[model samples]
Target chain A: MFELLGIPPQALFGQVLLGLINGSFYAVLSLGLAVIFGLLNIINFAHGALYMMGAFVSWMLLTYLGIPFWFALVISPLVVGALGMVIERTMLRPLHELDHLYSLLLTFGLTLVITGVFQNFYGVSGKPYPIPAALTGVMNLGFMFLPIYRGFIIVMAVIVCFATWFLIEKTRLGSYLRAATENPEMVSAFGINVPLLVTLTYGFGVALSAFAGVLAAPVYSVNPVMGNDLIIVVFAVIVIGGMGSIMGAIIGGFSLGLVEGLTKVFYPEASTTIIFIIMALVLLFKPSGIFGREV
Target chain B: MTHTIEKSQADTPGPETQAMLEVQGLNGWYGESHVLHDVNLTVNKGEVVTLLGRNGAGKTTTLKAIMGLLKSRSGSIRFNGTELIDLPARDIARLGIGYVPDDRGIFGSLSVLENLLLPPKVADGGFDLPAIYELFPNLEERLDSYGNKLSGGEQQMLSIARILRTGALFVLMDEPTEGLAPVIIHQIGHTVRRLKKAGFTILLVEQNFHFARELADRHYIVQEGKVVDQFRNDEIADNLEKIQGYLGI
Candidate 1:
């Protein structure tokens, strides 16, 4: 029953836990955006749509095939990733020689088409995805009650983010990716199939987003527009973290989520606008972003 | 010199002599601008061939076209008897033709080791790490440094070392001595000669005629993207005045 800042400890801790959960999603989503932008040099406007597809795919698997949540988690990303690869090879590849604006417009249109298809079938209402029985309980952590599923999500997101970072920074394949990101022409001249690399990178990035969606289905309602609106916030996170920066996106996502959570407790009215405000301030002062190199 | 030329001419396993690379009628364009016009050249096995020209003479463009880096190119670029004109840049590289671009093309995000390891070995005879270290000792010292962090000389060395590690039988070096100190240029000259002596064919692009004169077995004087003249290194000594006139410097 103890109180801190004139608020109950339970309420405060609950908000903080919620913040951490949101932070995990932000980190994973923004990481996907950063990875895609790093090599492809295109802001995938369809990222949200892909994320939504992940959740829908999971739901569809569960309903149509009686597949469980755990299996859906494993399979949905691969399905979505393959779809992303197709989009890159068929749609985004031709736009590489053109202006960047065209790709952005194309992906934006793709987002609409995908959302429209889902809405036509499922409508705008949210569908519930029941949590697996193994994760359907809460753990008492002395200070606060933690949902086992939430804790699992936090751990999984952290692991995925760290793994991606390690893959890019430490490994030989990662070195090729980073090098290709800087100069694909040079990388190709070095005998790397850069087009194949591009396709796989875009696919990997989309898979990451879809993985986050799979994780999110149990927490948020599975809706047609779930990813559509969340993507705008993630874009703000990318801008704040510094576009195309891997570590920056991870840090920016978690920190912004915490800030948003704190705002909800202190000033509920400004919770939605806090991230945008910080983005504007960052743009004004450091347009390259917190982790972005000066062009 | 005649012994090496004749040795290359003989196919008795001395060193696989014969023209290793023959580029004929290479014309390149950048969008609508024609950069290379009817460029023709050849490089015998184990020979160092230098393409000497002033700036904007399409020396680099010639290399680009030959390497298949320029897509809007039409020419016969045959390396190791493989037709390279229709292949992609990567395929050309896979054919044991390594390219060290003019800008050095070092990725700033990669470490010295990563840059060296980026190129896949195209053949069995590529230089290993210890061999590369012995050639460019400075690169070994700065293996952990990022590619862009190295000095101009070290970067150039890394670029050359990178291609050499790919086991490329033939290398297209674009201005290996560009933007370096005189001392470093001397070191590069030494390295180029060392590579040649190791049985690698080199097609060098150089504005430094004096440097080229010392290292190359044959010289191709490129002017306005065309091979204006071809002569032996000994002939360069006799035709120095005329060569300088053609080079305009």
Candidate 2:
């Protein structure tokens, strides 16, 4: 059946699978943005820079230190997390009393500086990170060949996203975090150390972005510019999800990712612009977003 | 100044008791606009002092300054014998001074229980959730409801309950009855009486002469960012003319 309307099962299934994988990253990254914004009340424009750092750090470990993929996967997030904490304590803390827009500008400046420094050192060339030896093969189904690495990426993203969700929504520390975000002065009055909570929240958000970078390194070419375009897309996701709620971020990320993937198959030219268009529509129709409460 | 005494009462003791909080030459500014000028005040332990002032009389600014939430140009604020100038708002809060702003800084996104849980346990001790529930039984029914969803009265109760949870020895409440229903105001009055009976010191900022007369053991009339008049509880009946002139009550 060579009918245009009846697209082949293989093409449809492949696009759907691809959508699900892209959705995974969207979920994790947007979740991070939501969590950070809730407590710190600043959009972390440097999140994209941190994600690129994670990929670069992992690549450096492999090329120079001869460290394996497994170690880089685990250690890069911690290294980037430490860096995030330093940025928070030094750059962000001083600007807390000023308008929140200033912090956003500071982070945007940091992103430029980091991206520039990395580009100066590494150049624009995309470096290949070999798929881990164990995950190199493809699994053959009757209809398609599924890459094991791709499958692993989706699974790992889901697990990380769920774990982060559980930590923020279910734990006592998360409860304290929610409380602090609501009314920090009141929280402090109760004898809870609120500054520490804000710092840790910022660090955790950065760590989430770094973790996404490590996951992306082996799947895509490890490049200095990897996060440059992704950050814009993630921002759109956050806008559509609402800045206040964590779960909204995850759901918005994956759903939009899937929509983008589907558009790529049917209308390739619209794929890039679709998320922004969706964001504008959401802003016009439901300003608070799908899950966001009107503040 | 305009003051009203619904019922003439006897004068209480003078300010010679051990002062819990002392402000000397306290001047505050908001972006170059001087709001509190050489404002001096004293609150002894377990005293209910009412600050009477009209809008822009610096009543709210004084409370904010005491909590270290404002920039002090020149002032010495001592809380329980400790120097308070230059302390962060959070640190000042930890010193057992609970501030309830006129806006009633409610964490609208959080639930009633979550709002109660926000304040860190102060030296007086953290909030006993059960005790708060006892004070405002309506809150117990809406424990899981978001703060903004609560009614005006409920939010006021939640604000007070949140501060009480901090176990603060002293409370600075600004217009706690503003925009509240009469019944809610009566309930707050009862709550204040209960709080006073429990030995907590209070500095209340109010425009309502009736409410102030009922709660205040002493009164200070503020105008042009300075204390212009002072009176004992018994003096309220005699000071009605001054209160009306300044406060337009």
Candidate 3:
């Protein structure tokens, strides 16, 4: 294998591949956030907590119930999504008439409660979730040994993102969601139940976060603190992508993940702060975000 | 078309009759500040009733209250003999009351066609897309354009068209011609005339007295959140002074 600029090709390509995988998660999570924010007008601060819950739920299913990873994968998101619906109906619905900040605060409080409860029960230690037996293999390319699971993750994320984009951009239900986001009263006047739609939209978005959480559970430890740090990164991604667009969320997430990964390769110390720095730059130059439209 | 004539003939009543839409002692508050107080009015089927007032005269608030957008304090709103005071905005809408806010409630991010498609078919009566296109020809041309990208007149037309897609029998339109060019205002006036001809009941709120006078068969002037005066179409000319005094026009 030839070395470029004294760096081995394998190492460079491997980091790039890893960056792309991380980007996949970012894209999926931020896409969910954008969808939720577009309709709910609420920055779901509890998104990370919900993500953690998704992972924990899967872990619980496997450990206590003796459920297989395959079943847990499908069932955990639904469980978390149901929980999201209940939260939306009970808590978020009451704050609909209030300021946008109130919804944000309420979601933040919810995140704290969820995270605290999970931590109190599970402790701060990370729990290992075994990779499904079928996915426990590596495919060696000419340059690098690629984990089959990571590749599966990237493909699944892409499919999910595209499916969501189609649902929102091309479908009638999506039309109603977009319309409701713009003028809820007007949509309600059309005999479409706007409140029910709001709750469902919130649940869908939370389910997306949970989906990402379940996908990450095998890669990362199922920890109570799993969502906290990832969410901060996602916020930066959203700021860069702009909340006004669904595609922007996807692109912003992946691009920033790749950028962060590259930063780790070239300058490891800057990796942590690079996303925030990019966010500040985007805000300074384009406050609406790279893809965001002005309200 | 035959039914329209029958409905009009049936609508003729003596001095007192049951109203199609009735608001009595209606009061509304935004937070703590009372915006509408003791507002009373009635709309008969096949009527073009205009609510005339100056800025901040609670004209728009009355429409919102009817649509259940505001918190009703002490009032009775009966739309087609159903109490609307405690109902949600969606329920009021399902009752065949279409509300067009003063802002022209267009979904800016959505295309004009998408905006039209946003409102679900109300009461299992299918929406006639061609009928709406016939009403607003400009909307037909700019079907792919985003609501925000439309001209003020186009946005207004789309707003009205959006509501019409719901097949609502009663429409409460707030300032459809506000800030529009004269040509667009003429178009809206024409649309209102067409709507009235089609046997649609309308409660229009407008600041332009001239426009209101042209479209309205009956008028209710509001001052300080109360109905101050009422006039028949024939009495409007005679009551211009009173209208000017109240509206400052």
Model number with the top DockQ: 1
On lDDT, the leading prediction is 1
Residue-by-residue lDDT tens digits, candidate 2, A1-295: 2424567767866887788788888888888889999899999999888999988888899999999889988888888988999999999999999999999999999998998998999898988888889899999876777889888888888888888888876666787888788767656645567898888899889888888888888887888889889899998999999985787888888899899988877888998999999999999998988888786
Docking class of 2: acceptable
lDDT of each: 0.89, 0.84, 0.86
Best by TM-score: 1
Worst 10 residues of 2 chain A by lDDT: A1-10
Q: How close is every model to the real structure, measured as TM-score?
A: 0.96, 0.89, 0.92
Q: What would you estimate as the lDDT of candidate 1?
A: 0.89
Candidate that beats the other on DockQ, 2 or 3, i.e. the better one = 3
lDDT of 1 by residue, B170-234 (tens): 88999999889999999999988777767778889999888999998888888877888888888
Cα displacement (Å) at residue A165, model 3: 1.8
Q: Encode model 2's per-residue lDDT on B1-249: one tens digit a residue.
A: 111111112332334568998989989899978878899898887789989988889898888888876755568999989998888777888888887778787777667787777666676444477767778899999989988898988888988888877768699999999999899999999989877766678999998889999988888889989988888898878878877888886
Off by over 4 Å in 2: A1-5, A93-105, A133-146, A169-195, A293-295, B1-17, B124-127
Better of 1 and 3 by lDDT: 1
- lDDT winner between 2 and 3, please give it: 3
